[model samples]
Target chain A: MLLQFIIGLVFGLGLIVSGMSNPAKVLNFLDFAAIRSGTWDASLAFVMAGAIAVTFTGFKLVLRRPQPLFGEKFHLPTREDIDTRVIAGPAIFGIGWGLSGFCPGPAITALGFGTAAAVIFVAAMLAGMWLARFIANRPSMSGIVTPADRVGA
Target chain B: MPATSFTPVASAAGGALIGLAAVLLMALKGRIAGVSGIASRLLPPYEDREFAGRLAFVAGLVAAPGLVWLVSGRLPEQTIEAGMPVLVVGGLLVGFGSVWGNGCTSGHGVCGLSRLSVRSLVATVTFMATAALTVFIVRHWG
Candidate 1:
């Protein structure tokens, strides 16, 4: 738990330092068509590149150790196929992210800034998560079910 | 929104720190540094593995800004230009869609992709492309 807490702290601090908790910067980064207006903000692309480069090297080194530093096995995602659930879900998620210039990690960290928008956004987000549980439980939508289903339902 | 306002060097430095955090989580806890997944697992019916870990992680996230304030002597800027209704709808979509998708930017974009997961690659592309399209529509066409 202490380990997780420290990592989250580092992650959150990284977010603020990267200017990610700033919605205005995020919005400006997504303004792809801004080339015409000479206002394109490409800083985030650099951000992702830096992150991916480091993680790619670090994860590879760690995975080769046979087991994690603290666990018996490395718990990793195994699914490889890209189904509708994968595409559709993130597509919806993207729309929401673009509309509000917030994603889960940054949004949660932003709560500490004590902005009313942050509070409302977090509250509504929780409500959405609650609602999704009900939606995911319905057997009507086929293809694949929740993690619970995969665990043997 | 000017190009002059962008801070690539600082952004990259921050990104490296984030990557370090993700890598550390995976190496030490053997868990993905997925914010939405961790947060969701902590919610009601919280019959989750690493309950303490989840709670502690979230607490750390909530505490980060305060730490920054102490060091930097100012709170980080959190500008939300969107109105109440947009935030509401956006929050709903993000919260629900992340769960349904089984991941969000951190989960899919950072960790999953780094793990060489094809599904994460696809999801990341989908969300990023969709985000770009939405921005074009709202900022340009709207």
Candidate 2:
């Protein structure tokens, strides 16, 4: 438990230092108008690049082990087929990200600031999550695997 | 106007830290370190045996600003441009969409892409495209 907490702390620190925790900075990166006007911030691209570079190489080395140190097996995602939910869900998520420049990690991490806006966003986010589960639990939606029922779980 | 600070070094360092965190999680727990997965699983009908760990992870994340303040002598500046209504709507969309999509920027963009998952690649591209388009419409055409 402590290990996971430390890992999350590290992740949160990364979000802050990378400027992902700052919605205004994130918006500036997303704003294409800034590109033409010479105000665009491309730092987020570098953040992703650096993160992917390290993880890509790290995973290659780490997954070679028979099992994780503490667990019996790696519970990686089992599903591979590209489905409509995959497309539509991310598309909708993208719109929200563009709208507010705040994604889940940063939004949660930003709660450290104790801002009312962050609190409100998080509360609404939880509600939305509950709503998604509610929709998927309807009798007609049975057998359809929403994210609530991911293969790993 | 909010100024965009070009912080390549700090951003890269931060990214590396995040990658390190992901690596540690996989090495230790065999988990994906997906924030949405971790966070959402904590909600109702809670069945995860690892609930305590997940809650601790979130607590640590929420406490990060305090860490920064301790080291830097002040909280980092954050500007939220979206008002209450927009924040609420956008928050709901983000929460719902991430749950419906199965991941978010951290999961799909960082960890999933690292594992070379085609599904994550598609999700990443789709979201990036739609996000860019949304920004265009909101900032330029709105």
Candidate 3:
């Protein structure tokens, strides 16, 4: 638990230092107008590049181990299917991300600062999460099922 | 929006830190550092023995800015152009979509890409494309 907290702290620090926590900075990067205007902030690209490089190397090293140091198994995603939900879900998320320039990590990190916007957004996000599960778990909505059908019955 | 300065050094350093965090989480806990997944799992119908760890992780996330403030003597700059209504709607979409999609930037963009997952690649591209388009429409046309 202490380790998880420390990792989360580091993750939040990265969000802050990378300026991903700043909605304005993110918006500026997303705004194509800035590109035409010669004002595009490309910091996000650099951030992702740096992060991916480290994680790529790190994963190669870690996956060599049969199991995690503290856990019995590596709880990585096993799903390989390219389903509709994968495509449509991210598309909708993209629209929201572009609209507000706030993703889950930054919003939660910013919540530490006690900002009204962060508070409101985080609350709404949690509510949305619950609602999604509720809808997905609904037997009537047979087509839309939770990733794990074990949520409730 | 006006011109904004790029912070290559800080961005890269910060990103590396994020990657390190993800790596550590995987190495120790054997779990993906998907913020949304870690957080949302703390909610209903998702029962696990790691509940305490998840809560502590989120608590740490919620405490990070304060740590920064203590060290830097200033709060990090965070601007939200979206009004309350927009924020609410956007939050809803982000929550529902990320949950449904099974990942977000950190998960799909960083960790998934690092692991060379085709599904994650598709997701990252799709989200980036739509996000760029959405921004173009909102900023230029809307």
Best by TM-score: 2
For model 2, how does the per-residue alpha-carbon lDDT over A1-153 read when each residue is reduced to its tens digit?
888889899999999999999998888888877887888999999899888888888888889999989888887887788988788888988888898888999999999999999999988888877777677667778667644435221
Residue runs of model 1 more than 4 Å from their true location after superposition: A139-153, B1-4
What would the per-residue lDDT of candidate 1 be over residues B1-142, giving only the tens digit for each residue?
A: 3233778998999889889998998788778888877877766655545788888888888889999999999997767889999999999999988877878888888887887888889989988988888877887783
Model 1 per-residue lDDT tens digits across residues A28-121: 8888888677787788887787788889899999888888788877778777776677888899889999999999989999888878898899
- TM-scores of all models? 0.93, 0.96, 0.95
Candidate scoring better on TM-score of 2 and 3: 2
- Model with the higher lDDT, candidate 1 or 3: 3
Name model 2 segments beyond 4 Å from true.
A143-153
In model 2, the Cα lDDT at residue A138 comes to 77
For model 3 chain A, give the 10-residue run with minimal summed lDDT: A144-153
Give the candidates in order of TM-score, highest first: 2, 3, 1
Model 1: lDDT equals 0.82
Q: Per-model C-alpha lDDT, please?
A: 0.82, 0.85, 0.85
Model 3: pairs clashing at backbone N, Cα or C within 3 Å: none
Instruction: Score candidate 3 by DockQ.
Output: 0.65
Cα deviation of A15, candidate 2, in Å: 0.3
Question: For each prediction, how big is the interface RMSD?
Answer: 2.6, 1.4, 2.6
lDDT of 1 at A146: 36
